[model samples]
Target chain A: MNGVNIGVLAVQGDVAENVLATQMALEDLGIIGTVNEVKTPEQISDIDGLIIPGGESTVIGTLSMVNGALKKIKEKIANGMPVFGICAGMILLSKKAKDRVVGEMDQPLLDFLDVKIERNAFGRQQDSFESEISLEKIGISKFPGVFIRAPSIIESGKNVEVLSKFNEKIVAVKQGNIVGTSFHPELTGDLSLHKYFVNLVKTKH
Target chain B: MIPLAGDLNDAKGIIKENIGSFGTKRGTSTLKRGFAHMLKNGVVMDVTTVEQAQIAEDAGSVAVMVLDKLPSDVRKAGGVARTASIRIIQEIMDSVTIPVMAKCRIGHVYEAMVLQETNVDMIDESEVLTPADETRHVWKWDFTTPFVNGARNLGEALRRIEEGAAMIRTKGEPGTGNVAEAVIHIKNVNNELRRIKSIYDDGDHQDLISIARDLKVSYTLVEQTASLGRLPVVNFAAGGISTPADAAYLMKLGCDGIFVGSGIFKSDDAKERAQAIVLATTFWEDPNKVKEAQKMIDERQSMLGLDTKNLELRMQERGSTA
Candidate 1:
């Protein structure tokens, strides 16, 4: 690949850290890519890959809709742009999301992934925890999973590949050009997950 | 199915026991600092009612500060303004998932204790509230809950850090709808930091000792701050942030985030203004983004203006030695 252009949705949640991680991932893999925040339709169209960070799903969803980024993102993802979504980002990417504590929510979502997940499945904010998850498909053995008010994948379509699990509860999934995770990879200092995503973007590009 | 596992059940049990267990010294300084870190480049709106707090949460505020009255109102209605009623604070807490912070007088340790017992996520030893002691502040090192204080210069910031304040904000004239004081205070801190950093680079720990004595903080902390060229804890900009432009200006000036006090709810279109401020704070570097945020609100509906010079009380001057 000549070069890759990556973007992180700036609608909400840990935007800078995602940018930093992606930059580090590029350096580690010896790849050249410019990572920037995508908030407008122009910014959206200018990226080869995108990452939706973990934050309040409802807020991010609503703001994206209001700002006209939601439609552009959905169109790009459907056109096979490799996208990574973490936590609330995962919820936004999933086709269906039901809250464990509050039941189903009516919030806007991208609905690009063929998975059904539960928001805050691990528990509340204070119930968040960190643990090791082994992802075989990514060629990584043990990865640190930081669950902060995270979601859980309860069901996945046949095309979706389960990447990792926590106590048999699905925490990661991938389908072709899209990847979603219930835990935050950016929060952890490890860069393998981002490196993997960058490689995915590289292959797709 | 994956498999039946007893270890998973034990993990669930531990979570169940630890849920809502914040009062028993279970929260460490690291945890508090981590929580505050999550609020960087975000907006924390000041709210007095559950309804306002709901608006704030809907507007994407990282947190809400529970207060009894708008700071301007507290200034207008000359009386002893104290901590907000726990009943109101509890109602607001129940209404929002974002952290709820309440203010106590500058030295009212008992009020802070009560707030901690109520399990508020954080406490503010605010000078905006009526001071319980003119010469002292709460020793926040004793509390599990983190405390945030106001500072006008490096000395005030270091002193508060020494007293265990996990965060600091410039004491701009609260409720004035003016951003000048915040601008001055932040610039003062930044200039002082640059001076300290230059001294440190010159290999002079001696100047830091005198600066520490002047700040009434430990010499080690001063040295560390000088070496880092920033406060150890997060420093947010607060007071008189009435517009998206104001929020963006402070963020560009190098404050960690913004605290909009009475600037959202007291203005017309609270929801729109609140959301606009959040957007500006998040994209402070982009002038076009800030312009878009500014166009989101109608300026004619802003809170009634106050000239900071005319205010009988300078809230920012309460504890300042500069």
Candidate 2:
């Protein structure tokens, strides 16, 4: 078995928690892996898989663009690297984001997930909430998911499988080796989702 | 003439001593100066892009909250974290003389440390949404620079102050887009303190301290609002504040100020809302003035999404260790 090395995008957002969660997930799964925070383009090359933690999407997109990691990440994903985008990370991976509250604020997306996202369809800060979701497609049932000013998947390509939804709003989806979630699975104490993503990495690598 | 010259020299020495004493009195002057600037002219704008941050500054907002894209993106992508990159923070700071603030996860001391080095004026230990550390609350005492922490009630506010926070804000429960809870919390705290003080005679420090200590409350709370007749120290209200009316409501509730995170920037009218909120803070008592201010806020409405509840829970779970 190849020892997996998972790197989290640490430019901004929940970098530390993702690292800890991933580390914990790997341990729970009995998988041999090293989790590290990836900031530079050079760091991206060393990881077998990458987790983009929840954070501000535009800032991450702009920083990735300026730091020259956006292209590198795209290239890596194109070359068959396993990547999981959570919340803002999912937004970055999508083909397009619509209904964005900021009005035509251009974001450089990864275009890996082949999906369209609606930013904050659930309302603003105080409207944030949590719900139990069933990812039956991925064998996940009754998973308590936290949605904080979360987005919803309005549309997805033929290749995309709707994984979960809350209040009929699409909150989780998976396309091939790429997994995207509107709600933060990492924030919840559930390691099953992380384990599921890690399985994708194992198969891909 | 010779004696007068010596006396003048002595007075100059005394003045220098007083200045030194003043510096010691304000142990965090470097931090307080930045906050004072925000209180005067800074407007907190909601933004999804570095470009939006720049635009907000240009449009008169002193600082901007970098969100994950924007609310519009939610229908297509889902709500995302809008954390600013170090480079972005650097750039924004470089662009404006006014201080820049960023949201960090509670107990994410490393992120706070990074922000401190970024030269930003204040770090909102905000559960504004998406925390980096899920295990601990970001105690303001842990950081070297001055920080503002959120409070949902008087107890929470007093705790933050006790933890050496330079400022406190009402946890404006993210994503609700309603200010009722914040207003309620503030009013309850204020009323409770007044009721407690009404029974005690003036100059009853011992009695007041004993009551607060017995109730497991902050001495600052009793001293400021209940005892010495002042509002709680460094109190601000955040979350669910959408209109000038909301801002005015908090001011009426005795909040020192308000932090309009998703409210002003999320509205269709950003500039007007920003200005209206400022006006509302200044003329909070006059309903007619507030009504006039409401017109201004109503004109500029935009939308953004925020989720600070999970972050708050995370902070609570972590407690005030970090």
Candidate 3:
């Protein structure tokens, strides 16, 4: 494939690291692409794919909306633009997010993926831990998953394929062109998830 | 007061004409001016909603902070950035006229740039929550946008100011919710400034720079820049500033203003507390005003569960890593 432009949403999240991870992932697949930071709605249109890094969901959602990228993002996704949302990004992509201890606090969600998430299901920051999960269903073996006050998929639609699970909770899921992960694959130094997303982007293109 | 506008303007013109005659450096005057402004009008607000920003405007805060959630929430959420949603920021901007600010991860300049384009008055380069890139501190000098960064001490504060920051703030170390750390930083900076002043008379810009370099502090750049005739813009104190007294105390210590995250809304009487903080910062030196402010603060104040010592230890740990 020709050089693709991959953008990492720079709206109040882990932008640079995601860019680096994506760059690495693309390189592993022998793909040529320019990984740039996309902050505004205008910049989003230029990218072939988008990565929403793990961050605080509320801030990311608020910032994206404020920057006028939310609607644009929905449009792009609807038009078959591949999007990978990690952690809080996953929360934003979900149809609903239950605020674990707080319960029922309404947060603005993107509702792209037909899934319900339990926000902060892993407890607090100190409760953050790592685990190896089988992505064999997606044709991968063991992958390290970094869960930091992570969200868990409580429900998924029939179309949503479970890619990985931990402790009976759906940690990774894919629905059509939209991909969501409750754990941070980017932080774990794993490129398979990113590689898979790139393949999705290539196929869609 | 006499109409000193003429004299001030004359002095400004002379200073401008002889910018080279002063033969100083870049950041001295700028830091001084910023420090002075913060002393005069400092107001901190709890920015949970657009409505809260209006309250901040009504109370006459110099700047408004947009948070998706409060410091307490950040702690509970494991250092997540939950401030005003982008929609909420739009609402808040529509509601108020003062400078609107938001927090993002350190080194997340892309977010800062986005906020800048959204017409946010400023961006707080603070670790109010966990940084998106937890491994590094965000450097603000790289962007064209004006930023106000949080500093744990005078050195850190001065460094950000030197790095093209329009403003500087003392980090209050949230979660613990105590102003003791802010107090210490203020005292340390003040003492350091006094020492710097005593060592050099006027026009000893080189000496000042050397001292700052030797100390490996940021204020050295402030001294160099100020000597070159740049005026400091603004400096504020943030983090554990909960009450009007706390706000007043920082103002007295030479902070330009105060930013209260969980301090205002976390209390039972948020409005009253917010009002009192406004009063305290505006009339910081008045004993009677202080007394009244204290009464209002006392009425609304609750025990903050912050362990200052533990936070200090964490700062030390983080600093070492940084």
Candidate 4:
């Protein structure tokens, strides 16, 4: 493989960790790629793949929406460019998201993944936990799943493929080129999932 | 901030080594620190009531820090400020979907415990309240809930990180509606961070060790911070951020986020101001967008600004042994 250009949506915070993780994932896969923090609409159109990291979903969406990057991202992902959305990212990709505590919210979302999400399904920050979980489909076992005020998939459409779950809740799902996880793989330092996404990007690129 | 590849690896190594042994699996450092990361690039507003919490949520604040009174009011009242009433905190928590945070007097562990019991999302070992223990801070490692501590410099930041804080914010003089102190604090922290980064790059282990000694933090933490060229946790700007431009300026200066207290509710158009600040914070890199945000709120409605030099109380100086 020659290389791939990867972009982490850099509208808000919690993005650096994803960039570092993807960078390592590429290096580990023996693939040469440039991982860039991208915020503009032009940058969005240029990436081979994109990762929307965990942060405040409202903030990321609003910022991305303002710069017209959200429109470009939706186009890119819809056109089969690979994307991995984690935690808040997972919410952004979902078609619908309602807060467990506050009921419905009006935050912006990409509405591409064909799933309904419940934000903060695991309660608030103190309830945030780290657990060993299985992502056997990706060839990893006992993966450290870090759920931080995480979301959960409440409903899945016909095309959604459930990848992983915790406590009987849908936590990770995929539909064609787009992958979404309610837990943060970037925070866990386990590169397998990231490597999986990088390879997804490579194959698609 | 993006760090060197080695620094990221070192952090990962640290996370891998220390995760499962932290008293229980439910609330490890990884979980705590990661919680803070989730709040990056957002605004956290201080709220005194459920109404304010709702306003903050509607305005797109990532979290709301419940307070018994606004910091300016606390300072004006001239009494020992303590943790907010648990009832009020619970009320605010129930009213909003966003994470709820509350401030405890610096070094008030039991207060933190009560907030944790109330199931608040995070706690601030804030200097905004009067310090219950002037020379010490709550040993935050014992709590399942994460802590965000205020720091004026790198040593204080690393020390808080050493004490198990998941986030760090500038201890700008709270209630003053002044952004100058926050600016100075972040500048100082960044300056010291760069100094250490240079030392680490030069491979001057002895100086790193001595500098670590001077900072009163663990040498390992100093090494990791130097290697990372930034604080290991998210750093937000706080205290006196009163307008969209104030928030945007701090975001431009490299704060991961902004914490607004009196800035919002104290202003004439609290809801509009809150929303504008959130917009400015998210789009700080684009001046045109920031201008759009600034235009959302009237400057005449902003809080009366304060000068740090003339303030009777420098809250940033409180509860610091460093």
| Cα-based lDDT at residue A188, candidate 4 | 70
Q: DockQ values for all predictions?
A: 0.21, 0.01, 0.01, 0.55
| Residue B169, model 3: Cα distance from true site in angstroms | 0.7
1 versus 4: better TM-score goes to: 4
For each candidate in the order shown, give its overall lDDT on alpha carbons.
0.81, 0.62, 0.65, 0.85
Instruction: Considering the two chains of model 4, state its CAPRI-style docking category.
Output: medium
Q: What tens digits encode model 3's per-residue C-alpha lDDT throughout A77-193? A: 888899999887888888887866556646567888888888777654323455567788778797876665678988888999999877678889988888888876765567888
- Winning candidate number (DockQ): 4
List TM-score per model, in order: 0.82, 0.48, 0.50, 0.92
lDDT of 4 by residue, A7-118 (tens): 9998775888899999999999999899999999888888899999988887788767867999999888878899999888888988999989778888898989898899
**Top-scoring candidate (lDDT):** 4
Compared with the true structure, what per-residue lDDT tens digits does model 1 show for residues A1-205?
Answer: 5699999998656777799889999999999889998988889998899999876777678778866899999999989999999887888898998877457777788988899998778654444565667899889898876766578998899999999887778899999889988877786678999999999998888
Quality of model 2 by C-alpha lDDT? 0.62
Best by TM-score: 4
| Tens digits of lDDT, candidate 3, B1-322 | 0001101111211121112222211112222222223222456575878777767666556557788877776766664563356788877766653446777666676676676557554566667745555455555544433466666654565555544455666666674568888787667666766666555547576777776776565544546433422224455777778877878888888775677878877777777777777767656766677678768766535545587774433432233124
Measured over the true interface residues after superposition, the C-alpha RMSD of each candidate is: 8.2, 20.4, 22.1, 4.6
Docking outcome class, model 1: incorrect
In angstroms, give how far residue B208 of model 4 lies from its true place. Answer: 2.7
lDDT of 4 at B177: 89
* B109-194 per-residue lDDT for model 1 (tens digits): 89999998787878999988888886888877677677899999999988887777778899999989998999999999999999
